[model samples]
Structures are given as C-alpha cells and as structure tokens.
Target: MSSAPTPAPGTSTYRERLVPGPAGVAAVVLFAVMCGLVVLVSSTVAAAITSLTVLVVGLVLVAVTSPVVEVRGRELHAGRAHIPVDLLGETEVLDADGVRTALGPGYDPRSFACLRTWTKGAVTARVLDPADPTPSWLVSTRRPAALRAAIEAARGA
Candidate 1:
C-alpha cells in the first residue's frame, strides 16, 4: 500500500478504514446462497426474499462495524479511542511475527489493543502518561509504516 499523503499542519495526516476483505464478503455471499438453496426446496419466493434480506443485512453490518484509524492534528484515533500524540513514546512498526508475540505472551495486561485477525501488521506505542493505568497501545493496520510515520510527524509538530 502507498503511504498516506501528508496533510497541512494541524490537519489529518493519515486515515484508513479497516473494511472487510473480498474473501469475507464472498463467504457471506456463499452462506446466503446456501441458505437460499435449502429454502428453495420448500418455497422459491420465500427463499429468494430470505437470501436477499440476509445478504443485504450481513453486508451492511460488516460495513458499519468496520473500524477507522486516523492521525489528526495532535491526536491519534483508533476505532473509538483517541490519545494525544505527545503522550506517546517511540512508535514501532511490527511485522507478522512481532504482532503475534505482542498479542500473545509478550502482551501487557495494561495495554489497549485494537486487533483484527485479517490485518497483517501493527504499530505499538508506549504511553507516556505516568498517571494512566494503560501502559501502551497495539493497533492493527494494513500500513504500519505509514501509521508510524504519521504518529511520529504529529508528535514532532
């Protein structure tokens, strides 16, 4: 993936929506088809309506539930949580192995992690606020390097 374009000072430097992949959509569609086929053995019209409704509802839920990651002004937003850029320590981009470890045995109980199995990379940042109980944040992303750069730039600004 390409790096996110740098925005003007105090503007959003990066933003991304973690939407469902094609495979996930396909799986939902396939399940709808299977349900339709089973119901078709009884009533064709009912089967068609049921499958259509299921497909529409399923896709809508998936889309609406997708998380957003953004770096705007002096803060970083991951899903519904936001933190000040200045309060973050060195941000590191992690590969698949590092992500696995961070999410596994190396994980800190006090850390906040927004993870998705589909996303391959992640960025980890230590929290600098001594009073806060949370030690760090682990954010899953498709573009870890871009996120790290955005956070670093925002911190500098």
Candidate 2:
C-alpha cells in the first residue's frame, strides 16, 4: 500500500476524502436516462445531448457534495462546517454495528453527518456549540481508528 501523505510542516493535518460508491453511482445513470427520455421521443440527437448534459451536471453535483473530514491545526472540518479543536469534545470510533445504530434510530436530526453507504465505520466528534443546531459530526471513513487517532493527535498537538 502507498504510505500516508505527509502533513505540511509546522502544522498537523488529518484528512480523509469520501468517494462515491457503486450504489451511489447508480443515481448518475438514472439521472442520465430520465433526462434523455424527456427528449428521446422527439429527436435522438436532442436525447443524446440531454443525457450527456444531465450526466455531467449530476456527476459534478455529486463530486462537489461529497464530504471531506479533516483535522488541521486547531480546527475540525466536516463538510462545510469548521469548529475549533478546543471546542471538540470526546470522539468515539463507531464499529459496524455501532455505525448502523448511529445512522438508524439513534441518529439526531440536527447533527452533522458525512456518511457513506459503503464505509462501515465512522467517527463521531462532539460539538461544543450549544447554540448551534448540530450536536456532533458523524464522519464516515474506511479507517475509523486511524481517523480517530489523527484527531486525537492533532488536538494534542
């Protein structure tokens, strides 16, 4: 396996990029077909163009919306929200079962979640923002333990 990339000097950074899984990718095809169908009965060329446009736009939307959880310097970044490291409370690494529960009945509607259907493990970071709607951040990752450790290490640093 390739080694982990080094973080920049004078700073500690742990970053994990989430990619679209096979199941999630199915939506792109569905979108393309739906767009093409709207024009297919009229003209094949129009259908083809619409399909291409929808596919490209759908892919870009998916790509842009994909989550990236990162701990850099004194901040924790989950999606578009960033909070200070000091404000972060205890972080727990969720196992497969734990992940399921967290995503299921135990899930809080107001909490921030960067979940992936493929990844079976996740790390939850307690948010200290009492005034904010989100209580914590549940970030999906293939290496849950490593992600947890990195957050701890960064916080300690």
Q: Evaluate all candidate structures by whole-model CA lDDT and list the values in order.
A: 0.88, 0.79
Error of 2 at 71 (Å): 1.3
| Candidate 1: RMSD to truth | 4.0
Question: Best candidate, TM-score-wise?
Answer: 1
For model 1, the run of ten residues with the poorest summed lDDT: 1-10
Each model's TM-score, in the order given?
0.88, 0.74
User: Model 1: how far is 9 from its true place, Å?
Assistant: 8.7
lDDT of 1 by residue, 1-157 (tens): 4444455656888898887788889988988888888899889998999899889988998888988989998799999999998899999999999998888877788898888878899999999999989999999999999999889877773
Tens-digit lDDT track for model 2 on 80-117?
A: 87777667688899988988888787778888787887
Candidate 2 Cα misplacement greater than 4 A, ranges: 1-12, 103-112, 116-118, 127-135
Model 1 scores a TM of: 0.88
